[model samples]
Target: MSAEKIQIFDTTLRDGEQVPGCKLNKKQKLEIAAKLDDLGVDVIEAGFPISSPGDFDAVNAISKLVKNATVCGLTRANKKDIEAAARALEYAVKPRIHTGIGTSDSHIIHKFNSNKEAIIERAVEAVAYAKSFVDDVEFYAEDAGRTDNAYLAKVCEEVIKAGATVLNIPDTTGYCLPYEYGNKIKYLKDNVPGIENVIISCHNHNDLGLATANAVAGAINGARQIECTINGIGERAGNTALEEIVMVFKQHKELNLYTDIDTRMLTELSQFTSETMGMIVQPNKAIVGSNAFAHSSGIHQDGVIKNRETYEIIDPAEVGVNESSIILTARSGRSALAYRLKNIGFEVTKNELDVLYEQFLEVADAKKEVVKEDLERLMYQFNQTVETKFA
Candidate 1:
């Protein structure tokens, strides 16, 4: 538990697949887990073994196949689920069994129709049962955001005493904001005994799109491990994105926390997940999106042509994206057109430039925006002129 390292626990094969239409077969689950390992996540949460036969076989296969990352299986607060998860993780060199129960009053009263004491007891028993089969045990507090902090502290302490090595606090409903989530972690850090000895992990959802922010805020308040997925794909609005968290750490080096993720694999892996899950990555989504590095405005394009830093912050190559784009559109200027044409290895004489410019404007008028291929075709229509460097 070095302060310099931030452990990444990827649940793409489990929580990510929990979405109804996104349910993956055994082979698909294992394939995703393998890719997650290749991306260098510290823990691979394979699946909830007892949830389904398909999940059981997938977890067992991943536990046997994935070598570097710790293989983990999820369980509820019951002995049957705990034992089933343990059976699934038995083949891994380093296996972790994660088990937990609801600690919040709303969940206990409405969801489970139980009392606080009974919920705490169930969590401790589950963690103890999981510990019987594996050295690594993680206990989670479902919907801890609305749970009374003091009661949550009591449950966490009891589970840790029962041999839980990692205590995961999930914002199950994605209801808490960053400021509140950070304070919650700080509260646990101050209240739970021997908390410093055991790793504290954060599992925030993105129901309100604050999962990544809340997770980073948790780290700032002393949580050491983060649970996430590549493209933020999960139930509801999705979970915190693995790529977003890694890039945030890279950009803010002052935090001094490091992850094992190879940033260069972010895009390829995101594309794979999007394609496999039958989901499309939004064109304007933060890091791995198609428009993440694309600029179209005249002023922005001018600065980008002069110096990339004028309009860009992170280099696209660092995140596995190829390059920034100067998209031509109906509103594009001659300077941007000239810049883009030269980038495609085309030169235009004064007369040819006028003709190409008119043609580009006509094409741009037809479409909302002119992309690289459109510009290439338009340039090809004109006589290739070998001219002096214009930039």
Candidate 2:
């Protein structure tokens, strides 16, 4: 792989399922996992195998089914969790055991009730234990977004020495700004011993709605792997959106970075995950939303009608969504009005359209959008008005 290539680690089956009321059975998870592998994600965090029997089965089954992507299972910093993750991934062709512990003072003081030294010891032991089961071991410093950089680097260096091939620096609370997150990654690169030997993975949350930006910032700084989920769905606000990160890298090649993702599969993956998970994607959501390519304003519609690139940066077809939509609303321009009229089988002269445009706006303002039937009725009424004026 090129050094500039960013690895996409999709955690939809794990973190995404954590959303309240959004649960997928084993079969559904396997189906989505298959699609994710086909979509070209570098790693698929199947689930936290030690959390539930259902999750263990899902990870085990996905491990056997997916042919391309490396199957990963999450575990806490403990013997039982790491052992369960290893057993769950026994059938995987390429298996990764992701294990980690809280490193921030808040988590250390409150969540774990431990000190920095104890956290580092647990982190190193966990990585070593996980590495015993699989060649690829990913160590996540949970809440690294708020952890002291020097201490965080200490834990990372120890884990790397203990055989972690990937170091996951997660914005567990979604607290870091982009520059802060970028600086954190850079600090590790400059401070951590033997850091260049392992992949620096960025796992950011969206509490502040900057997960994607922070992830990009980490990539620009030093991180080579991005951990995200489809539709940005997860606990609380969400995680960095997989579609957003992939599309950003695809659109901005000037950064000299790329992912192995098949950009066309983004929309399909988003729809399947949404349907299976029972979460409705917001219409204005980025990348795969219903309104991502829909234009309703007159100026936007006119620009899109004349040249799609005028209004759209990424082609709708590129993501498997339908073509751009020219919706007629109260704000529509004469060009859009005339275009719609022609499509509905009426070829009106500019003068005739000028008379119809005023009536169209009145009807459009009354409704959210004017339908074809409404437009036909308005055209007939305009013709009658013209006849009366002449008679």
Candidate 3:
């Protein structure tokens, strides 16, 4: 109804840590949580406390330490899990309980062998029970992407009536496309009673490589919260990346959806999560990847050198990345070589470029990447005459 403001719900500690070999200790979790606070997240899904004693301690520590962001603990539709989450969140300045159960037919047949009426009952009870312990309750419908839209609307209505501050609809398996996920959120907005008062959250996985796209689409429709992780590291291909979603919102000004995220800390935060979680971010990954702004090909390098807008939509510095690179290789043309040299105060004529072009080929044969220093060393070695005035 009003201008949309996308809330950032970071699930790095919960789902991101679920990645194989990504276990973080209490201290490590606290370190990450503290950084998440500085990075300006709206809510931090601290951990699933009932999963393990270590998780319980980590969640509790995060609840105590995280002062600005809402510290949240996850629970299943059971008393033990809900109680553990409540206990872990006792120390939080603003605490929240995130509890849910599967609602899709496949999950019902395989995971629970349950019926729709029973799932709705559990969903309502979970939200109510969670609300009893804490004022802030977020109810999730697991596998919601595949759940019946009408039933999903009904479930969301009941949960909002039960005092859910946020409703999370997760494409848990990364199966839903952009159109479907946006419709899911729009369905809830149009059908679910009292939905306008609560935040609509989208949790997407990247198995199909549409996580961030789905998230941005959700925001564009009406969903006001995104459940994301740094570096997009999570169970499978990871959730929507916090950095990617924020940058997308920034780059697309027409969307007009804003988050509390500190834009500058994105790079450092991405590096921390990737290293701490033992997951190496792919170079081609959007936003936080090493090559998100890198240009190696000759034509692309020339365009970027002439005007960043030729190839780049957003400035590299917007996401804390240093600059676009012009990598020198056999594929790189003489224009790129002279452009890079000119930036370093070397003046070279067109004819001189022809002379260095052959030398660059020889240099490329030996070096994997031709750095500026490498070019300098090559110049020193050749001491040859320039066809024109080449650097």
- Best candidate, lDDT-wise? 2
Worst 10 residues of 3 by lDDT: 380-389
TM-score of each: 0.93, 0.95, 0.95
Error of 1 at 281 (Å): 1.2
Q: For residues 1-391, write the lDDT of model 1, one tens digit per residue.
A: 3438899999988888887778787777778888888989999999999988888898999999999999989989999998898888889989999899888888999999999889988888888888889999999999998888999999999998999999999999999999999999999999999898899999999999999999999999999999998789888999999999999998888898889999999999999888888888899988999999998888988888889999888889998988898888887777799888888887767777777888888998899888789877776555343232332
Candidate 2's C-alpha lDDT?
Answer: 0.93
Instruction: List the candidate 2 regions with Cα displacement exceeding 4 Å.
Output: 1-3, 379-391
Error of 3 at 227 (Å): 0.3
The segments of candidate 1 whose C-alpha lies over 4 angstroms from its true place after superposition are 1-3, 349-359, 371-391
> Higher lDDT: candidate 1 or 3?
1
TM-score of 3: 0.95
Q: Which ten residues in a row have the lowest lDDT in candidate 2?
A: 1-10
lDDT of 3 by residue, 10-115 (tens): 9999999998999998888999999999989999999999999999999999988998999999999888899999998999999999999998999988999888
**How many times do residue backbones clash in model 2?**
0
Clash pairs detected, candidate 2: none
